[model samples]
Target chain A: GAGVSQSPRYKVAKRGQDVALRCDPISGHVSLFWYQQALGQGPEFLTYFQNEAQLDKSGLPSDRFFAERPEGSVSTLKIQRTQQEDSAVYLCASSLGAIIRSKNIQYFGAGTRLSVL
Target chain B: DQQVKQNSPSLSVQEGRISILNCDYTNSMFDYFLWYKKYPAEGPTFLISISSIKDKNEDGRFTVFLNKSAKHLSLHIVPSQPGDSAVYFCAAQHNAGGTSYGKLTFGQGTILTVHP
Candidate 1:
């Protein structure tokens, strides 16, 4: 695809179950980020990946949330033991550069909506 | 505590008119600000951005103004169109060095409705 792509647009999981969401960033992009958006709220940053290195994970709410980008192109966000509060849209974004450049804009993917019942 | 806040939950404007959306942030270290537009079932699309050093940045009909002293920013859309109706988000980043990276702290978005 020409832009960032995310898999499993919708996922329904029972409480205590685990789920994994995938994101395929724009080809050759070096930066990737994951955010979670609850109902009627803005997306909150979760983690960031620069190429294959996980540089920042400060915004992650809990230890149950995990993300990785082994090759720096595709990334995955996994939530363990889902709770009702975990039900939200998980968004993925990618930028071309690692530093703050003049045109470093992050392009987002149509997020994966998760429902924890 | 909410670092970034968009107090107005919604805004309505008529076509061909100007629409202003406002945001405020408590973090003084933030140096980069961005505005994003999102549609239902779609991801947020980048709109405009302004660096803390500049008070204003303009791109076509969209302009973003920053007030460092007030810790506030506003996005102006001139001649609003129906297509511009969507949720707008204000995001801030502290781009000091490697410590901050590009993680964005976003404000609760504002819903903009453009009536034709």
Candidate 2:
């Protein structure tokens, strides 16, 4: 794809229900990122990946929030027992990975709007 | 704590005028800063970026100014058009040694309304 792609443009889940969001990054992009954007707020970092390696997961809000980019391509963010506070937009981005003396600009997907009822 | 902050939630500007969006950060570890423009129902698009080494960077009609000493940055758009109305976000990048090392800290965002 020409840009990063995300699935389920919108998701409505009841409280306590589990939901999964998928992201398809640009081909051959070595770095991928996940972020959560609440209403009226900027995208907050959730996690990052360098290829298949889960190099960063500290941004995950809770133990129930999990993300994996297995095989260094497609990634999934799963939230267990969703709550009302989880209502927000989930964004996925990809970059060219770390480069010496260069800025790493990320390309973003349209994002999935998750509304936990 | 919020490392990046956009104090103004919204700003209105006339078309053909310059729109200046301001941002402040607390972390001195940030090596790079970027500005992103976002429309409703769409993801943010990279606008312009500046490195800590330089104080200014310009691209087309957009220019970014960074003041490392004050931990402040601003984006200036000349001849603002109605189509330029959207949310503008400021982001700072930090690459340290940790699991979430190379992450971007973003501001709360500023909504710009350009009137024709």
Candidate 3:
């Protein structure tokens, strides 16, 4: 793909329901990131991946939030027992290289807006 | 605590005028800073960036000025256009090492409205 892609642009889930969001990063990109953006706020970091390795997960809000990039090209973010507080836009981004590299500019997807009612 | 802060929630400017947006950070470990512009229903688009080694960086009309001593940074858009109207966010990254390498700490966005 020419840019990062996210699926199910909008989702409506009931409280306590589990939901999964998908992200497809640009081809050959080696690094990927996930962020959560609440209403009227900037996007906050969630997790990061370097190929198939999940190098960072400290930003995950709670045990209910989980993410995986099994094949490295596509990633999935799953939220278990979603609550109203989980309502936010989930964003996915990918970079050409690791942050230590000078060319590590992140490109973002349209993101999935999840509304937990 | 908010590691990054953009005190102004919104700014309005006439087309062709300069639009200056300010940001502040408390963490000294941030070695890279970036600005992102976002439109409604779309994800943020990368605008410009600067490394801590330099105090200023410019790309066409977009310029980012970093004052390391004050822990402040500002983005100046020369001859702003109506198309530039959107929410702008300031983001900082810690690339020194460790698991925090790629994590971006972002400030609350500032909505900019450039009127024609």
Candidate 4:
């Protein structure tokens, strides 16, 4: 009955520092995704995972960004050597495999607000 | 190039009037389209969706229409209410993997103000 949730609702990091954001998807959800949204902009795809296997990471802005879903339900997005340009809200979403077989809605989390100084 | 676009940045309408939000996509591969609404301090919530296979789908007060030839989709809300005021985002997926996981693209979003 719980919705997708993210941790550290707000994070302030210095430039060049590393930050980690966490996401806990709904129980039994097989699909997890991460996205980045700059102010006044739409959320952009970052990466995706089906269970413990990453299906895509093409949306990662650069090499400094990394994400993993080791146990399959919880996911983490890591940004290393953060820059001012990296400041944005990081969103996480999940859905049952039904979205794959057809069109299913993605449940989103409140998101982690990361500010790079 | 942006795969999904919401040209109108904002719109204001009187309550009880129909509210129409439009979205355009340049990528022809996108076949599944969705609409989401968000209020301040919250993540987006799903509003409606329309697949390429169907030209239109309706659910209660919301309806989504897709025009594949134009690569456009529109969400229509009949009798819009003040509570409907929010930023609306249009999203699409290529459906390459059959499941929409890694490649859903979203529009810039349109802020709607419904005055009661």
Candidate with best DockQ: 1
Chain B TM, cand. 2: 0.95
Per-residue lDDT for B1-116 in model 4, tens only?
78899999999999999999999999988878889999987889998887789999999999999999998899999989999999999999776763344367999999999999
lDDT of 3 by residue, A1-117 (tens): 889999999999999999999999999998899999999988999999999999999889999999999998899999999999999999999998754545888999999999999
1 or 3, greater by DockQ: 1
Deviation from native of the Cα of residue A74 in model 2, angstroms: 0.3
Candidate order (TM-score): 3, 1, 2, 4
Tens-digit lDDT track of model 1 for A38-105 = 99999999998999999989988999999999988899999999999999999999998755555688
Report fnat, model 2.
0.78
Deviating ranges (above 4 Å) for candidate 2? A100-103, B97-101
Model 2's DockQ? 0.74
Q: Residues A86-111, candidate 4: write the lDDT tens digits.
A: 99999999888674434456889999
- Residue-level lDDT of model 1, residues B1-116, one tens digit each, is 89999999999999999999999999998999999999999999999999999999999999999999999999999989999999999999887678466788899999999999
List TM-scores for all candidates, in order.
0.97, 0.97, 0.98, 0.96
> Is 3 or 4 the stronger prediction by lDDT?
3
Per-model interface RMSD values are 1.1, 1.6, 1.2, 2.4
lDDT of 4 at A25: 94
